[model samples]
Target: MENDSVEGLKKYTANNLLDFLTKQIDKDLMAALVKELGGTVETKTNSESF
Candidate 1:
């Protein structure tokens, strides 16, 4: 699945959309949201990889 546009992730499956959201948001902030949701997030490199 490819999120080519700003709203592309909205067209993704639930889990994929969540993953895409996490990718779009700031890692630290998104990780906090994850913790609040009873989920864990990895602190990874912030790179826009192709």
Candidate 2:
């Protein structure tokens, strides 16, 4: 039971960390694209205006 609990915690932590890293990477990519397009990133609640 304890081992299962530890495994579950590890999986949860890994998923959270992966999600964070993915978001960071996506942001970086978006920034690079915007720079390449010669536009700015304007973030909105439901959409992004460049």
Candidate 3:
């Protein structure tokens, strides 16, 4: 099952992978609520990070 998921992810380009991961992080942050940690989360794009 894990291998299948990995194989599926392999189809994505580097930019797509970064975008997907960023969105996922944003979702997690929203769910967790950064205010609880006394901080805010900034979701950046692939180009913005570099």
TM-score of each: 0.36, 0.28, 0.22
lDDT of 1 at 24: 41
Q: Compared with the true structure, what per-residue lDDT tens digits does model 3 show for residues 1-50?
A: 22436654433332233334445755554523333323333444542321
By TM-score, who's the top model here? 1
All-Cα superposition RMSD per candidate: 10.3, 13.0, 10.1
Rank by TM-score (best first): 1, 2, 3
lDDT of 1 by residue, 1-50 (tens): 23435554433332232476634455555555445444444545654321
Model 2: lowest-lDDT 10 consecutive positions: 13-22
lDDT preference between candidates 2 and 3, better one: 2
Clash numbers, per candidate:
0, 0, 0
> Which of candidates 1 and 2 reaches a greater TM-score?
1
Give me candidate 1's TM-score against the actual structure. 0.36
Off by over 4 Å in 3: 1-32, 46-50
What TM-score would candidate 2 get against the native?
Answer: 0.28
CA RMSD (A), model 2: 13.0
By lDDT, the candidates rank as 2, 1, 3
Reference-based lDDT, residue 49, model 2? 53
